[model samples]
Target chain A: EAGVTQSPRYAVLQEGQAVSFWCDPISGHDTLYWYQQPRDQGPQLLVYFRDEAVIDNSQLPSDRFSAVRPKGTNSTLKIQSAKQGDTATYLCASSFLGTKDTQYFGPGTRLLVL
Target chain B: QQQVRQSPQSLTVWEGETAILNCSYENSAFDYFPWYQQFPGEGPALLISILSVSDKKEDGRFTIFFNKREKKLSLHIADSQPGDSATYFCAAMTNSAGNKLTFGIGTRVLVRP
Candidate 1:
């Protein structure tokens, strides 16, 4: 089976500009997650969905960042206004269930904000 | 404060040697510990994991030794290869509260011939 898929493998934008990342999780996986990984840092959870409902988004910057999984399949994470610190690899992942020991990740979208 | 911490921001080892990576967490509530591996231009993949109830778990050349009381855990890579060189991450999860996985700053491993 194909693993999770993401779009725009790399993106470079000026500060204050906007960018949106798209993710398609593995087939039949009920959970989807979004994470941001700065260079040399671990991936941090941004938001996630259990089916089409948001489960947790506390770590997400509510002011400028937003994510949604409306169809219980595809998801989109958007940064309304980018900043230099926003530069990171945006990752998408999925799992079969909440208690699953493993999560499959996408190739990730590398964002370089200047 | 960072919830999870990992040591040796980067590591280098000879091929066929065992590489040990360390991780510790402050929150006692974290019961699930996992390690992730990522290569350049690729997403992180689940490498191995151990639960609070177990002291160790092994798969192939990888093994995870966990200590609940010390709030520490480690990953051991046996018979390492150049292909094993990648960024490794340690994470903890308690989904009921946040469905989030707190992660340590990754450790980049470089295996030499």
Candidate 2:
């Protein structure tokens, strides 16, 4: 089976610009997650969705970050008015439901904000 | 606060030798632990995992030794190969958090041939 896939392997933008990252989870996976991975740090959860419903987004910067999975298969994470701190790799992962489910990750979109 | 922590940000070992990576977590509710491996330009791939109920889990040359009381775990790669060089991340998840993972900074391993 195909693993999760992400678009725009890299992005460079200036401050206050907007950019959107897309993700296509593996087929049949029900849970999709968006994570921000800063340099030299582990991935941090930004938001997640089960099917088309969001499970949690408490960590997402609401003022600038937004994500949606309309069809429950593909997801898009967008950043508005990006800042220097937003310069990090945006990773997308998917998994099934259950306590023992293992997540598979995508290649990730590396963003560099000036 | 960082819930998961890993030691020895970087390590170097000779090929055919055993490389051990250590990790610890502060949360008691985390029952699932997984180790992920990533190359320089690739996303992380699950290497091995163990549930809190088990003290040890083995898969080929990789083994995970878990200590529930101390909330610590170690990943041992036996007969290490040069291709095994990569960044290894230790992660923890709890059922209450919708199985969201909290990961460590990661340990970079270099297996010299």
Candidate 3:
């Protein structure tokens, strides 16, 4: 079976620029999540959605970060006015509904803000 | 304050030895615990997980030991090999809180030949 997929394996941008990451979850999966992992640190939840509706995003920096899952299958995470601190690997994962079972992950998008 | 804490920022083990990674969480509401393994430049992959009802879960060379009262857990890798060298993260979640995983800082392990 195909696992989750992500686009733009890497992106480098200058401070104050904008960058976006795209994620396509596994087939039939209803839940998608976005996580940010800094060097040598664990991944932190940026946002998550269930069937096109945001389940939680309290951890996301609303002023700079925005995520959307329009049709409940694919998701996009955008960072505006990126700062050096925003440099990290953006990971996408998905799991089936009702069953918070194991999440299938994709090859994350590595971002570097100069 | 960080909700999840992982011990031993890094560790090194000889090949065929055992590697232990520890983790603890402050959120009592967390009912699901899982361990994730990540290789260089790759996303975290599900390693193994245990629900609140069970105390131990074993999958091949990996095992999870959980203590509900202590809100602590550990991952034990037996016969550690060079391929097992990576960063491991302990995470927790709850049905009521959604699927957002609260992860530990991560433990980097290196297995030598």
Candidate 4:
């Protein structure tokens, strides 16, 4: 089985620009997650969805960051106005609902805002 | 506030030696703990995990020793190899919290050949 896949392996933008990252989860996986990992730091959960319904998004910055899993298989994370502080790696992961603890991650999209 | 904490930001060990990574969390409600291994430019992959109900879990050469009372845990890599050189992150989650993971800063291990 193929693992989770992400698009645009890298992205570079200036402050106030907008960028979007896409993700395709593993087949038959119902739970999808988005995380932000800064350099030298661990990944921090930004949002998550289960079968098209958002389970948690409190960590997400509502003013600039948003994510959606419309069909439950694919997801998109968008930053309305990127900032220098937003320079980090955006990672997507998925797992079966029954085994939520074991999440598989993608290669991630490295974003740099100048 | 950082919910999870990892000690010794970096470590170096010989190929035949063991590498020990420590982690601790402040949340008492966290019931699940998972350790993730990440290479430079790649996302983290699940290495091993343990539930609060268990005190220890071992997989191959990796072992997780948990102390629920003290809210501390450690990952032991036996007979480390050069291929094991990577950043290891310790994450914690709660059953009631929608399985959202809170990760530590991570410990970068360098295994010398």
Task: Give the candidate number with the greatest TM-score.
Answer: 2
Candidate 2 C-alpha lDDT tens digits along A8-70? 999999999999999999999999999999998899999999999999999999999999999
Which ranking of candidates, highest lDDT first?
2, 4, 3, 1
Give one digit per residue, the lDDT tens place, for model 1 in B10-99: 999999999999999998889888899989989988888888999999999999999888999999999999999999999998746555
Tell me the TM-score of model 1: 0.96
**DockQ for each model:** 0.73, 0.83, 0.77, 0.78
Ten residues in sequence with the least summed lDDT for candidate 1 chain B: B93-102
Interface RMSD of the candidates, in order: 1.8, 0.9, 1.3, 1.4
Model 4: lDDT equals 0.95
TM-score per prediction, in order, is: 0.96, 0.99, 0.96, 0.98
For the second chain of model 4, what is the TM-score against the true structure's chain B?
Answer: 0.99
Tens-place lDDT digits, model 4, residues B1-113: 98999988999999999999999999999999999999998999999999999999999999999999999999999999999999999999887787688899999999999
Collision pairs in model 1? none
TM-score of chain B of each: 0.96, 0.99, 0.98, 0.99
Model 4 has a DockQ score of 0.78
Report lDDT (Cα) of residue B66, candidate 4. 98
Give stretches of model 2 more than 4 Å off. Answer: none
1 versus 2: better TM-score goes to: 2
Residue A35 error, candidate 4, Å = 0.3
